[model samples]
Target: MRFEVLILGSSSATPIYGRHPTAQLININEQLYLLDCGEGTQVQLIKYGIRSNRIKHIFISHLHGDHYLGLIGLISSMHLVGRKEELHIYGPPALQEIIDLHFLHSQTVLRYPLLFHPTQDQTGESILENEHILVSSFPLDHRIACTGFRFDEKKRMPTIDRTKTEAIGIPTAYLPLIKRGNDYTASDGTVYRWQELTLPPPIPRSYAYCSDTVMTERYLPFIQGVDLLYHEATFLHDMLNRAVETFHTTARQAGQIATKVQARKLLIGHYSARYKDLKPLLEESKSIFPNTDLALEGNWYNV
Candidate 1:
């Protein structure tokens, strides 16, 4: 099962140098999910050779232009190319109105069905779930109503040790019970522990995306223990006042939040355009959380 995130764009406010905005393409169990379709995201998707049609779901963090400006373009492109599968979008309620207005004036009806799911801004709640993963949206401390998303892989079932079962001539009918943690009894009255007849499954993996949020503890519980965390670091600590006023986090503060949440690894992004050189931001974040890495465009981070 492949679980990774491809950074499409990470620059904040505007595109500077080689950085774009805040778009990420997440792949989990071979399904692709798009997060935050910033301006030029469609172009970045093409540049990265991503098959956009495979992405059935899109999650927008907020209504910020830097976060969702490219959505119309992407949808239009999908329509132009004749997409037939339904596309599901999860975002604030206002996002549905925005999308409707764009297409209304353009007189464009998509060939594919576009389903809009509104996300809550007051509390964390499961917005989407499948056999492999669960996605929850939680409120963030931003100037505007914003939310972060947490993707958690479902717990896997333990596998049967076929060699041991076959050696003991255990009936196939007992396999299900053994998988359910029941002890297996032999005809001679010997017992085999479920743990002894099975191999433990891999630990569930999780990833969290925090876009345009200030460093606050409000969303900490929702993102705790994520295998990979993508948190916005719009400025350096030297501009802490600016960061607080803008409701954005500094690089150093992002690191602190990652540590507090016990993130296994952190990818800091949403960089302020003022920074053409991201080395300082990476250094600042690493000071507090040594596992921090810069979320640069075109880079993929595996979970």
Candidate 2:
């Protein structure tokens, strides 16, 4: 279904080590869904050869400057480019206000429709769904009203067996019904079971993004068993105290969460500026969760 993630920026509060801030793109079935528009996100999008007009949805985990500072610029650029399609943004309620204030002061009105979906700070909710994927937002343990996002591929219909169906002289019109798990009755009254004529559906895959959060079990259940999990690792375990103080996570702690949640693979990022080299962070996460990888910018991770 072409479900994959492209890391745009992975820095923490400040851009360092040649990294920008936190931003990413989740491509599902050829459609692009943006998550967390940190500073220089549009530039990264351009550098990565993605069309800004192709992004229909933007998900912001919080209103933190490092997380959403690039939103206004991106929006303005989209407007300047003459985009006319509606743009949907999912985030905390105050995010809309922030966006509105910026546009209002600049005396600029977007040519495209701006739709804001507010995420509850206290509870999780289904924010978006389409024929291909279901997206949900869950509360995260952060200094602000933060939330993590989960994208689950929708269950696919059973595959129709063309050999069996054609052998039985079934019309093409009935093929869709077969895929939908419906039995077919031949003109002669022989009943063909749908189960016998179709292959089992493929297992759905999932990806979760935990933008900026401290180590806590509160969000574990929401993201459990994700095929690919993106978690913030703002520091190493050596700076565990600072991580806790700032409501951020350490690489070791991120690995622990990945293990506790039983994630198949973990992508750790949101690196603090103090780190010039991210290999140590990757090594620390790999210590506990051997399937962990660093969320390096410009890299696409398949789900």
When summed lDDT is taken over every stretch of 10 residues in candidate 2, the lowest stretch is 118-127
Q: Which stretches of candidate 2 lie over 4 Å from their true place?
A: none
Candidate 2 lDDT by residue in tens digits, 1-303: 799999999999988778999999999999999999999999999999999999999999998999999999998999999999999999889988888888889999899999998888687788899999999999999998999999999999989888898899999999998898889999999999999999888899999999999888888999999999999999999999999999999999999999999999999999999988899999999999999999999999998
Model 1 TM-score relative to the real fold: 0.95
TM-score of each: 0.95, 0.98
The clash numbers for all candidates, in the given order, read 0, 0
Residue 269, model 2: lDDT of 93
What's the lDDT for residue 122 in model 1?
97
| Model 1 error, position 296 (Å) | 1.3
- Candidate 2's TM-score reads 0.98
